[model samples]
Target: MTASTVLYEPSKDGITTITINRPAVRNAVNHATSLKLAEAFQKFENDASQKVCIFTGAGTNFCAGYDLHEVAGNSTGEVAVGPVDKVNGAFGPMGPSRMQLSKPIIAAISGHAVAGGLELSLLADMRVVDTTAVFGVFCRRFGVPLIDGGTVRLPKVVGQGRALDMILTGRPVDAQEALAFGLANRVVPKGQAVEAARALARDLLGFPQKCMQADLVSAHYSAYDSPSLEDALRFEFARGALVVAEESVQGAKKFDKGAGRGGKFEKGKL
Candidate 1:
């Protein structure tokens, strides 16, 4: 377990937990923070022992977005550290409101998830918001638009009209409303979102890996309307065929061993 400023702790069962550490600034992401995130994500990906990743922030907020003060500042003192490179993403893309992660990532959000914070929460494959949690696309009012996955993923997770309502108005939605909108999978008491997320990850660990990935791929592909229904079906068939070779064979054996429908799914737990 490598030491990291941005806490990255994994359980024995392959669930890597990542907690944003800058609580002093509402866990606002900065250059150093992004690097830590990237390193943690890459490590988890390479471990092979890990399967799922859970992301959360320490303290009263999940993430307040980027460090605005740092972004606004122009000076770096008298260290004589050469020119400031304009190339962004010096830190990896694993920061708040970032890119698509290959493995399923769960977010446990408590307190406020506003602006880029809310956008960051959207990165997770599944989100469990605290009952007191608040979500807002508030950056519209501040002129900082959801630069991450907001404009794109939000509409798909919720409905287009609902997403537009939030984006256009920059209104805050509570946990119950988020659940109704499908933005969050579950809602729990404040400070318990992480526990809930862990339980969900444990459940996911029981599911077949190849089957889940194939299903995940098909679901992602389903989001894009194909040229024809047949084309879409063909894509699903191909994904399904790949999984059938692995999980299907084991599934048959499970049935033979009296572990059929509704019984506990065997987990190789790699």
Candidate 2:
């Protein structure tokens, strides 16, 4: 992989911003770029100092998906998609798409986040999109399948009917529509996605880390792992019970003194 294929920048305040740099093909992931992307996310995961991640693309676009040129050149039937152990840190065709990351990730989408790009965005806990951002299953026309958690995650994100419509039709869903679909958490003006995501990260930083992470894991487990309502409640209670002694007691004490009352949040006071 080229050195510039992916850029990993970690801020002093615990935010890691990972950018795909191949804008020539709208930041498409070639095999080499995919390796770089996997490595970049690995680096972020290893760093205990980093609390949040902002995944984005350089130039105007987020990513156009995998580079079909590489696929066109392959005479052998070998492809980027393969069997992976999702519990371990296995690289997907779109890099970190298969792994369950510990920290929160926010995707700052500026342009087309389509096909595999759309799958990549699904890896994020939240997507902060700009006015120009476009999302779709653009590879349907090319007979390409969603190999990197797209089928599983898309249905979970936008529900079965909406996901099937996008998957079958390959129609572009604009930013406003994506917001309505719950595909996007926040939408901003053009050229402001990254800044908006960074600002959101700052807010996340103010919260107690362990409590936030525990809640995040619980939510994900309930969404994807829990077999029944009883099991989900049991798991949530077990996880949250640990945080009560660690963080909730202190938080409650602060609330008693009016730290976060009346919906007023002061970072230092909290």
**For residues 1-270, could you state the per-residue lDDT of candidate 2 as single tens digits?**
445889999989999999999988999998878877888888998999999999999999999998888888876625555323432648888888886787899999999999999999999999999999999999999988898888999999999999999999999999999999999999999999999999899999999988898889988999899999999999999988988998999999988987888888764337
What lDDT score goes with residue 32 in model 2? Answer: 77
Residue-by-residue lDDT tens digits, candidate 1, 91-164: 22224344455578899998878776777787778999898788887668656555556787789889899999
lDDT of each candidate versus the true structure: 0.75, 0.90
How many backbone overlaps does candidate 2 show?
Answer: 0
What C-alpha RMSD separates each model from the true structure? 4.9, 2.2
- Candidate 1 error regions (>4 Å): 1-5, 74-98, 224-231, 262-270
Q: Each model's number of backbone clashes?
A: 1, 0
lDDT for 70 in candidate 1 is 58
Off by over 4 Å in 2: 1-3, 82-89, 267-269
